[model samples]
Target chain A: MMEFLQQRLTDLELFGWDEYINYWFFLAMMALFAFELIVMAFKKAVTWNLIGDSITNFITLFAYRFIGGLIYILFYLTAFFWVYENFSITQLPLTWMSLLGCILLADVIYYWEHRFMHVCGLGWATHTVHHSSPHFNISVAYRFGPLDGFFPFFFHLPLIMLGFHPFMVFLAEALVQLYQTALHTQMVKKLPRPIEYIMNTPSHHRVHHATNSKYIDKNYAGIFIIWDRMFGTFAEEDEKVKFGVYPRINSVNPFTVFFHGFTKLGKQLWEAPSWSYRFQLLIRPPIWAWEQEQKRKREAAAAEAKASP
Target chain B: MNFFVSALSTILLGLVVGFALSLQKAEPPTEFEKYSSANMDFATMSEVGYAMAAFGRESTADYFELKDYQEYVQLAQNDHAKALSASDSPQVAASEAQASKAEAPTMQLAQVEHPAKPKAKPSLKDWPKSVIGIQRSTELINVEKVWQEFASNSALSDQLDSYTVSVFAIYSDFNSDYSRATISIGYDKPSMKGEQQLIPKGKIETLLKPSNYGNNALLNAWQDIDYSKAVKAVVERRDYTQNSELTSLFVIYQ
Candidate 1:
């Protein structure tokens, strides 16, 4: 059993290690909820904001983790058996430089995947579920769309083959995630200016969820803020940014939350005027669709008024 | 008042949880905890020492394909020590004299060839030699295939008229001395029937190849096994020559 497990641990890389940390982290998350329920007693409404969101989101995330881990183990095992035995794909140099390169490249991909979830149409579909509840707190941070499971992390096969020990990579990814989880709470509002500049913050994440113009679509970082800043995706939360999207999907059904993006993707593609519009509907910014529809409505109103007058 | 009560209740619950976790800290498997990596710091013997204590029903996976059926042949408990000694037990020497030169009981020969083959034991000066010989290939039986032929012809045991017993896959080189592994078989007892039985280590036959195994490329996907299953700890042990082929061994352990 130890032999079997050692191979798995070595194979799980940092991912397994992150799970190691998460066991304790999961305990910590539960303890916070305990404090909220037993000490503050949920009646203290503000605590609910964090505790409520966190508990609900965490339960869902936990379910996904259980299911996802089970499924991925099958895939990872099949892949492991074939590749570890037959191939010498440890082609990537296992030096610190290579490790650094793999991790940074992964972060780069993650930053964009995250950014795309915020832009409207796509945002309304996938990212809005997170902002759906009328709550913002540590637990809210735990709430993620089930669709988020098909993340870039699973797609990182080439990176593993490139020389990253899947184990170490998993650890790095989990640490990055754990770090992100720490930022979800309203408890910590600000840090030193230098830290704020480089890291994603509750302040920045608050902005990303904000309906406020200045704040929307800003401050997307997993472990580093430089990705967002470099890509001009950074927005600072100044005014109290309203959470949740306008003309919200408004459904509490988690099923809706899961498929809202997919539904919107289909809707935008179908209702689009031209092939390019359709293509853009699928790929372009959310604002483009809104602008085009607004123009069409104004022209139709004018035509009606002129004929009647 | 409600807030205070909640806090007190939670603190109590936490204490209970801590107690439960602490209680679980005691158990035999704690040393084996964290299957991903056993605490090798406490390991003094070769890595195989870890395998002997391998436990828990969860560990059937580590066991190989269940060639499930097992049969035990009990010799007199007294012969156990004799059976364990190098094959030159007085019983064996007497048995060999009654047997053929080609089939001589060379169970204690120090040479690599069949001791019964009209050859003298090779001098230690000729050690490090690679000789191709067969290991015991089947399950253990008190009546060996070679011995069965002799005993039946001699009509030694009255039961031999209908006696059909299994042959243990052990190769005794009347010539060269060989190394051996010890094995233990568990005896499950029912409340009402079938007395508990003692099973000896079934001989696992190894094929001798001229090529010896190297330090680096020994076996693929082989895990460290528990080396201390010695029900009758044979002092014999075996290692490899320079270029041993991977499939050169076929074995059955009792």
Candidate 2:
């Protein structure tokens, strides 16, 4: 059975696994959309507004797949190959053990990368596009910035430099991503106890997408739920999850979804009184800017009151 | 050929779905639409703190007291739920405003008192005396030439091109003072000639060790040196080029 699986994997690898997966991915997406329509008919589970969201999300995914790939080729490939060749500690061969090792390591790195995106403002600017949609469904899963993966290339570079083949590392990442895409749903309420306990489930991912106070930035696992559980970042799905970015996207414009955070950052930078505040606007968590703005408003109010008195 | 066919079909399928979606009429605005826009007025400090903490950034939580922490989180959660529910009618919106007014005390407190900033001590000076010695390395023998070499080096030439070389040290817990550690590279070089404490000068001893501090090795290293000490340490490179070294020395220091 192991040999058969490995053989299939090798054949798929030779045939370009990502492309092969892409063919199936579209089919699965259509099936999911159809399923959502059925569920909505009976239960009012989705809306026409969500369809518009899904359409915009589809545009992002299309751009990310084609244009993002071109950008990666022009910028990332050469440096990545150089780093792997020069700096890698050990070269692991293609075997079951190595593949498993690569997958596990890739997931660990992904957990951190996911957490970093939530923690830092620069990352949040890129990643907030995914969370902008107020509705949570399979369609929202594809709603990420076109160039989102560029920054994460550096994040995953360590895996390649640790002697895992870049292809293996990326393959593992693709598998992880495929698993995550499955996660962006409301249909599967919660899986079985063991599955929920071990792997990232729809329930856990809902909490990640939620802008509810309890859920804002929790459950940042890629494959395993254990990373969040072990790392003190875990929150159980006790409260009802409110999906979308906090201070939600008003427009369904794909360009607005893609560049809103950047636009906000640019505005903040222009208005900022100090260089430090401007830098903080660029690098601090998303909330930091909001808090600073509140502070400035309060200060201005106090000054106005004093002047009037 | 199969891949191209499949990819093209998928793209076309997406376009079809998108066109269908665009044709569908948008639903009326939900009652909660007012609260959907990102606004600081709606968010509490505790909410912000908890949000930051939820992202594994626990340091932001330092400002909140234990009492305020629970109260703020509870209030924030309640406010969020209320905002979500207020869209039912004008009556609910009125009640939501009242409820928001009730929650304003904490928000007022947050505005009245600015939280204390984290102290900034030069990383080198604050270095745990246990950092018995410091070593500095360069790609070129001449310290001045190192900057030009880094600038020219293809690997280190990018927009985000910065690297760190640890000035390694060996310190024993048993010997608190004068535990012998060598300053490995550039001890006699022009970089080390000035009256700078850049190199470990005398018996380097400190109260803290690598294990004493938090897991962030970078933050710990940053706190180890004073601004002047760091300047002194890099005095040689400053003369040759305006650009700073990509090297960062991350030592475990309390």
Native interface contacts kept by each candidate, as a fraction: 0.00, 0.00
Q: Give the poorly placed runs of model 2, Cα more than 4 Å off.
A: A1-15, B1-254
Instruction: Provide the lowest-lDDT 10-residue window in model 2 chain B.
Output: B235-244
Q: What's model 1's lDDT at A109?
A: 48
Q: What are the interface RMSDs of all the models?
A: 18.3, 22.2
For model 1, the local distance difference test gives 0.45
Tens-digit lDDT string for candidate 2 (B50-154): 333343223323322323334444544554565577654234433443454444223222121111111222234533222212233432224334433433433
Tens digits of per-residue lDDT, candidate 2, A207-228, equal 9998888887789998998878
lDDT (0 to 1) per candidate: 0.45, 0.56
lDDT top scorer: 2
